[model samples]
Target chain A: MAFENYVNSNESYTSNQFYEKLLREIPDLIFQFKIEKDNTYSMPFVSNSAMEIYGFEKDFLEHDAGPVITDRILKEDVKAFLKSVLKSRDTLTRWNHEYRVLLPKKGVRWLKGSAKPEAMKDGSVVFYGRITDITANKEQELRLVLSEKRFEFALEASMGGVWDWNLVDNTVFYSEQSMKILDLDETEGINSFENCISKVHPDDQKEYLSDIDLHLKGITDVYENLHRVKGRKGTYKWILDRGKVIERDKSGKPLRIIGTHTDISSQKEREDELKKTLDIVSEQNSRLLNFAHIVSHNLRSHAGNFTMLLDLVDDIQDSSEREETLQHLRTISNDLTQTIEHLNELVSIHTEIKIARENLNLYEFFQRTLNVLSEKINKHDVKIISLIPDDIHINYNPAYLESILLNFTTNAIKYSNPERRLEITYQLTYEKGKKVLTISDNGLGIDLEKYKDSLFGMYKTFHQHPDSRGIGLFITKNQVEAMGGKIEVKSKVGEGTAFKIYFNEKV
Target chain B: MKKFNDVFVVDDDKVYHFILKNLLKKNNIEVNSRFFENGHDAIEGLKENSKNGTTLPDLILLDINMPVMDGWQFLEEFRKIKGTLNKETVIYMVSSSNSPFDLNKAKDFPNEIQDYFLKPVCLEDICRIFLN
Candidate 1:
């Protein structure tokens, strides 16, 4: 109706001039495209804005616009652009396309062309359309796509995935990477927050729920927890789950939450390894300190004796007395060398060597030790009672086993009471899933209540026996401990002594 | 100054016993001195002396790190029976160990132990101890 009014009430221009003026006033490049009988395109009408949009002179485009227009189209999109135009012409349909173009003035720009095509009686088609400079809109759209892609890439790179939870609806949305980490197929029913929580390991659910509850209640800024998530096969993977309450109601009640799950199983394994190494280092440090104390005390005793003896040798003037004192000096010097050798041996005993173990019969080893000590046993009139079964075997280092047996049995004999007939009993039993060998002696038992702490210490003597050099039990203790065994002694003054050797045997 | 009529040298090491005996005799500081092997033997001697109405030693040289009852155990027992003794014995702890643990431990018995000495006790230490 407006067009009719304007055409009839022409001011100075005619109807064609008025229509042209209208088309040129629009903010688009309006055009009429004709496909002739030979399938060549010609733009019969084009607005003046074509010069500004396409960088073409208006007269040149109206005369022959096909070659210049096609040349300006981006090389990569030329084929597709032409194909779309032809399709629109043949189908007599609207042509709508957005494409890039290389303009003479503007280097490169995004353009949008939309037109409705109509068939004519001459077997040619025409499209009345408009083209607009959509460079800004296209750039904005591309930036949105790029930012989305960057977020996806960041999630993938961190071995983390996003999760959106709606607290009001109790629904959860998991990203593609989240599904993969949970070992879930798309069809699996994990859409509910409850269902997702069920996948948390039973042991970790308490902490996970508490962390989320705290954040939901605004007690914490973020909900974070290191938890194990159950897999499809019932195995678990450690996940560092972090989330924040993103939306809340007016009353400060959480309505929505967003979070990320990072697979931290490998990192957890490394932490465990670091902890174990620290434990081993601390253990070695303590053992080294104990060894230092032993070295200091034992060496000092020897040095002090040598000093006192040298002083006496200077004071003695009689020839026979001087000779005797010198003899004592020589004896003490030899003792000092032996003490140094023992210390060296003690230092070398603390290595982790689980090899060199042999299966040896306990009864037979005891029999051999008894046979070797028969002379001493007879001289002391000792009665030996052994209760070990012949078939009982223990896994131990053979040399250590022999030394342990010899030291303990010889100790029992040497400390036997002279008032009563000396009796030694060897018994074997099991205590707390370990083989325990008990050696009892009805002898001058030690005052264990007074000396329990230092019973097995190196160079510690508990009796005045001439043969009590205080090294046998120390060496025996070291050998037993090296073989992964422990010794416990129970004694009473003047009654008897019982030693329990607990052996660690793998069956 | 109180004269030391009776002195007890209590030690497990035979070498210390020999050295102390010669040092005392060579110095001509004559006293009725007795030697015991360890704390157990010295405690037994003290008990015997008490029972026989004999004099308890005026001075006792105590050695730590002996076989049966160590110096610490002897001091613990001595504290209980000390009130019955006729004289307050001047006790000195002599040890080969110069460890801070042993030295600090001797300081714990301020009333009982007169002093702690690191041994190979010199003639000067002997003279100072006799003076005490």
Candidate 2:
């Protein structure tokens, strides 16, 4: 017996009515879709829920709802809906699809449909299916995908890598990009908090740890630090690291922290370059100020002398007296020319871009200087002692070395003590992997305490000697500095003086 | 009676000494003029004259930028011992420097330094110091 006939024989059970009531009560829109041999598509059976889902009347759908159903499906989804139905009919397979449909009362809504297809002996196919509203679920999925894409772009644009630290577990987790930044191999597994900290440069580790500690203790709103980290190929890169405590315990202690590391080495290099250029510019400014002072003071002294001599000539009535004053004027004019020449030499030295240099024997230069001052050395009965090795060589300008040697030697002879026999000693020593030449004399030493500040200043004389023009030491100091060297002096009153010249070998 | 009996000219430049002496002689301000090349010698001469009971110069023409001891150093030393001397001396600072740094520094020693004169000081400047 057929199951419907068997239930009908009892006359009390209404099987068709029971199933129709069940379909009406459910939330889904249940239906049977069909395709005939002539390739015509139709929805032969649809439940009453179509009224709620698509705003259609149940009576109208029960009659011939195929056109209304197709029309209500959005224009963009109609093609895919038809294509899926045809595919299921031809293959006699289960049909599954999600699509959008438009309605009169409501706007566009998402629907999901799933059904099983069966082929009939009359060359027709049928699909029994159900479709529920899936609009809310789809929108949530799209929003998630958009947020993930934005995060990916931010990391790629900044050359940043993410790091997560679980404070409770003391474990560190680095994202794939972080591994690339730290240049760690994939097999290097399970980084501990200590292991991650070891990658920070020793000089920067202190501040980096202190910053995180501050954030953990709630002393800071966010942990931010700029420090160096050991990077690829054993080099260091400056990193702008920032993080925040996302989770905290009841005691307000941090449980988890996440941060980003951005490579900022290039920015740090530019800052250092700016600082160095500023230093050089300020140094040049001070030097220019000093040069201006020299020009003003020296020239004014000569001009003032000329004016005084002219006044004297005007006041004298005698011709011989006037002629004598005129002779003083001539000498003053000569002195003015010499002062101008000295100023010109200083300007040239200051403007020199490249100084010529050669490898010269230091002992030979000293010997030549001694020979040139042989007459004065004998006249003063000064003992010239040379403790310098014959093979000692220096890279320097020839004229500068000769001039420096002669100036020191002559100054020693000139300032020799008259009461005591004077002895001048020259020696070469190596200090800090560089050559230092020392010249010592038992002459009248300067009072370094009183004149140390202006010892190398132009026209600064500390002695009453007739030959003390006070230009030689100033010029010697300029030459020494021009060749990337430095000079220092140690002296005491009534004792002796020693001049030590440090030569830069790398220059 | 002459207002100044003794004068001291402390300067390093020989030409300045010559011109000042000639100008003074020409002006006929008869006084025993003494000269020292530097501040060191000038202070030493002052101390020696004080020890020997000789009269200190009533007028001092001081120059800046001298060797061994500068004008400022001389003033510092002079301030320490000026009260011990029998006579009071007036000091006039003379220098070729027109730097405001030097001029402002001169203002710091008002009691020790009476005036600051730019160099090539004329006979009129000398007359003002002596005749005033």
Candidate 3:
């Protein structure tokens, strides 16, 4: 008998009621769904399972299941549910599907269902199906898929490689991406942990292995280390190696290890370069600061002298005193002009090291310099001895040489000693493969011991002469240095002074 | 009779020395004046004056940027034996540098080092030091 007949024909049997009641005892759903040719849906048969699954009375659903079933189908799955049902009905075949449903009392659930449909003479279709709860299996499938997708994306985006190791057998499986990262094309595949560790740099292998040991010992959650790895060109590249003990035995011993290695060679090089550049910039910045301070002080002195000298000229009334004031004014203004000229020269001297260097004969340049200062030489009655050989030559900037000679010779005559006749000597020689030119004068020699530190410093002078503006040696030093040379001085008080020039000490 | 008994001028610039001397004379406030070309020379003069019972200047105007020793270096040397001097003297840092580095140095100078004056010291600046 049809189960509906059994229930209707033997209502008096308590087992029939017991089974009707037993349907409520279990959670499975049993029902018969039908669709009229008019496409209206209805439930022809619903056991007590309707109340358990749909939270409704069987009697109520047998008459009104059309709206209730479709509405409770979890709107997103309703279309597919209808499509599957229609296809099964039109083909007179079995309907098999898994989908989500809204159980008013149970929030929502995944139901796996199958049904076979039959057609009536009146063109009505009917189906019998059972849908059971499969929420646990569906959720497990989803979590597994999502985790797999995340791991795949991580390896792809990291542009690195993944490695898995079986600790028990000492075997390692390197993914295709991992071999590609290590630039290994052999398809025989990496088979041993020993083989993988052998490719690591000798200096990094010890630490890399220890990290894995620590992770396996349950001392660390993951093996995190950074070291160098041999790359394709036999050059070692910085690699950040990270891994974790993914599986362990009952004794908490490591069973499986998985990890990745990222190339960090370029990043490491950039960091080191930045560190070096920052150091250089800091040193140059300080030197520039000192340069600015000296320049400002020199300019201030000249300007300050001019301010007072002009004011003094305005205050003088006596004709002779006014003339004296005017004379001093001319000298002060001349110093101001020279200071500005020195400043302008420094701009070129520091930045224009590209000046042309020529093989300059020392004697030829000496004769040219003597011509420039012939008037001053005669006025001071100074005797200059040229001890340089006619063939002796040095690579030097012509303009700088001229200025250097003019400054040194003019200073020699201007600061000449009044107690004795002025005699200046020039000598050229080479020491230790370095070309040297020495200029000596019998003028009032400076106390070198006292002024040793500041002899070549800017605006430093020792003489009490009115013409000693303190700019000649400063300029001469700059010019000589620009041509890649150094100046040395030796002096004794009241006797004589000597200046030696070393032409580009290459050795 | 004059306002200042004696003054010591320590500067590298002869033009500054000449201007200062004339300014003192025109203001008619000078007595005997002593001059040193640099801080080193001034230090030596002070040492000699301290050894001999000579008259130390009542006031000293010191310039920075001298050849051998700058005003700061001179002050360092002066602080060593200033206590042995028979006379208490006031010294001023006269410089063309308006840099904060120099000014802060002067502000922290020893008590005997009186004050600082930027270049072109006029009659008024001189009177403020002597009259008080």
lDDT score at residue A351, model 2, on the 0-100 scale: 86
**CA lDDT for candidate 2:** 0.81
lDDT of 3 by residue, A1-507 (tens): 135323346355555565667667667777788899999887766666667666666467436675887788898998999898889998999999988888878878888888889899999998888777788889899998999899889888987788888898988777888777676767536677776787799988899889888988988877899888776689887888888888889988889988888877899999889997786556445534544666577667767767777777777877997887777778767766765676688778878847788888878999999988899898888888988999988778888778777777877786678999999999988888888888899998888887664555533542323345355676677667666677888998888888898788331
Each candidate structure's TM-score, on Cα atoms with residue i matched to residue i, is: 0.68, 0.69, 0.52
**Which candidate has the highest DockQ of all?**
2
Query: After superposition on all CA atoms, how large is the RMSD of candidate 1?
Result: 6.7
CAPRI-style quality class for the chain A–B interface of candidate 2: acceptable
DockQ of 3: 0.29
State how far residue B3 of model 1 sits from its true place (Å).
8.9
Tens-digit lDDT string for candidate 1 (A295-380): 56556766776787787777788898888777777766776776677666666666545637789999999999999998998888
Q: What are the per-residue Cα lDDT tens digits for candidate 2 across A472-492?
A: 777777777777778899998
Predictions' DockQ, in order? 0.39, 0.42, 0.29
Highest TM-score scorer: 2
Candidate 3's displacement at residue A4, Å, is 9.6
* Residue pairs whose backbone atoms clash in candidate 2: none
